[model samples]
Structure formats: C-alpha cells, structure tokens
Target: KKVELVTQGEATELDKSLVEKITDPLTHLVRNSCDHGIEMPADRIAKGKPETGTITLVASHQGGSIVIEVRDDGRGLNREKLIKKAREKGIDAPDTMTDAEVWNLIFAPG
Candidate 1:
C-alpha cells in the first residue's frame, strides 16, 4: 500500500520555540496516520477505495490558539477489536461503553 501526504495552511506562522515543541508530537500523529489509519492496497480495493491512501495535515489559527489536524482516508478504528483488546489487557470494557470511550482505549497503557 502507498500513502500520500498533503499539507495545508502552510502560510500559518509560529514562533521557532513553539514549532520545536510541536514538531515531535506532530510527527508522531503523522506517523500514526500512516501506520494505523491507512489500509493495505488489497483491503482498500475490496472496500471500494483507491489503492493509495491519503493523509492530510492542516494547521490554522483558531481564536487564541493554533490548531493542527491530521486526517486520513481509510477505515477508522474498529470498535469490537478495541473492546476485545481492552478486555484482554484487563481493562473494564463493558458492553455499555460508548463508541467514543472504546476508541479512546487506544491511548490507554497496556
């Protein structure tokens, strides 16, 4: 599978220190998008999507803060898989948990 990166709002400027502070975290987000968010070529084709996945990074100023967003064109988190993993890790993953809660389990420590 192939991944394409598209960046937007390149004109948005920030202080050098702020950029340095954010660089690592932003890189991590992009890497996660490529690694976890994108699907393989066969999987994408089976799902009726193009063979190549796209990850978009956008930076903009909103109110008093700068916002950076990473978006990907791929299958999103699998709820059942996440819940199963959480339970396997001994986390309390009840059937009543909301979709958002299940998704957030990805951030939980194993």
Candidate 2:
C-alpha cells in the first residue's frame, strides 16, 4: 500500500530534552500507523477512498502544553477483533466496555 505523510506545524519547537524523550514513542506511532493503520491500495479503492493512504502528523501549542496528533485515512480499528485478541491474551474485555477503553487494551502487556 502506498502512503503519504503530511506534517503540520513543523516549526513548532519543543525543548531538546522533551524532544529526546518523545522521539522514540513518536516514531513508534508513525511506524504503526503506516504498518497497520493504512490499508492496501485495492482495499482503499474498493472502499471509495483514494489509492494512496494519508498519514498526518500535527504539532501545536494548547495553552502551556504542546499537543501532537497523528491521523490516518484508513480503516480504523476492528472492535470485534480487538476484543477477541484481548480475551485470547487473557485480558478481560467485557462487551460493556466503551470503544476508548477497548482501544486502550492495545497498550496492555500481553
């Protein structure tokens, strides 16, 4: 699948220490977005989307805090699959959990 990366607020500067701390995790998120978030070209086209997937990274200031966001135009999460995988990994994933809660299971230790 072909993916395009778009970065916004590239000039938004952070402290060197903070940048060092966030670099690895941010890289991980970008990599995961490319590997798992974006779908194949054919699948995207079949879903009425463009053949090329888009991944966007934005950085900005909100009051005193800096916010970074990563977004992708792709088939998001599969709720059923997430729940099943969590359960398979011995993580209790009750159906009553909210979508946010279920998605957080991705960070749980397996």
Candidate 3:
C-alpha cells in the first residue's frame, strides 16, 4: 500500500516566479510526509489509524497573500521526544516549555 495525496486549492493563481520558488520546498515537504512524518502501515494499524496515510497539499489566496499548507495523517510530532532530543543536543529545551515551543525545536541547529 502507498500513501495517498489529496490536493486542494491548486486552482488558485499565483505569480509564476513564486510558484517556481516554492516548488523545491513543497517537494521536500511531501517527501518528509512520506519518509519521516507518516508511520508505516503496521505501525499505523497498531495506533488504530487507517493503514493508508494521507498527505494534503493546499495552496490558496489568503488575505492578499499566497498561502500554502502541507498536512499529513501520521504518527505526528512528540513533544517529550523533541524536548529530550533538544536537551541531548545541548539546545536548551526547558521542561516548562509549551508544546508549540517544543515543536519549534526542529528548526534549531543540532
């Protein structure tokens, strides 16, 4: 079985240069959804999720700006795991940090 892709708002218009610029990042994001974000079929079944995961890409005009989003049905980010990893990497992740802060640790350098 393979992961499914659901695209929406692709009909929205954007500058050709902007679309071209975002292509690389969008490709990386899609790869990430498959490789590092979604769980394997067995793992997903164990987690009580559908065996076939879904990745959604949406691009739209919002508030006069082009908005793009990539979402996935997957194992999802773990707050504790991220925090622990950050600390192990000496990234100064405090226990009291909020979930939002914990997730942002992925942007930090190792």
Q: Which residue pairs clash in candidate 2?
A: none
The predicted structure with the larger TM-score, 1 or 2, is: 2
Give the lDDT of residue 42 in candidate 1: 97
Better of 1 and 3 by lDDT: 1
Question: For model 3, how does the per-residue alpha-carbon lDDT over 36-66 read when each residue is reduced to its tens digit?
Answer: 7888899999999999999999988879788
Writing each residue's lDDT as its tens digit, candidate 2 over 32-88 gives 988889999999999999999999999999999999998999888889999999999
**Runs in model 3 with CA error above 4 Å?**
none
> What lDDT does model 1 reach?
0.92
Q: Per-residue lDDT for 67-104 in model 1, tens only? A: 98989998898999999999999999999999999989
Model 3 per-residue lDDT at 67: 89
lDDT per model vs. reference = 0.92, 0.93, 0.89
Which residue pairs clash in candidate 3? none
The per-prediction tally of clashing pairs is: 0, 0, 0
Q: What is the RMSD, in Å, between candidate 2 and the native fold over all Cα?
A: 1.2
Worst 10 residues of 2 by lDDT: 101-110
The local distance difference test score of model 2 is 0.93
TM-score of each: 0.86, 0.92, 0.87
* lDDT leader: 2
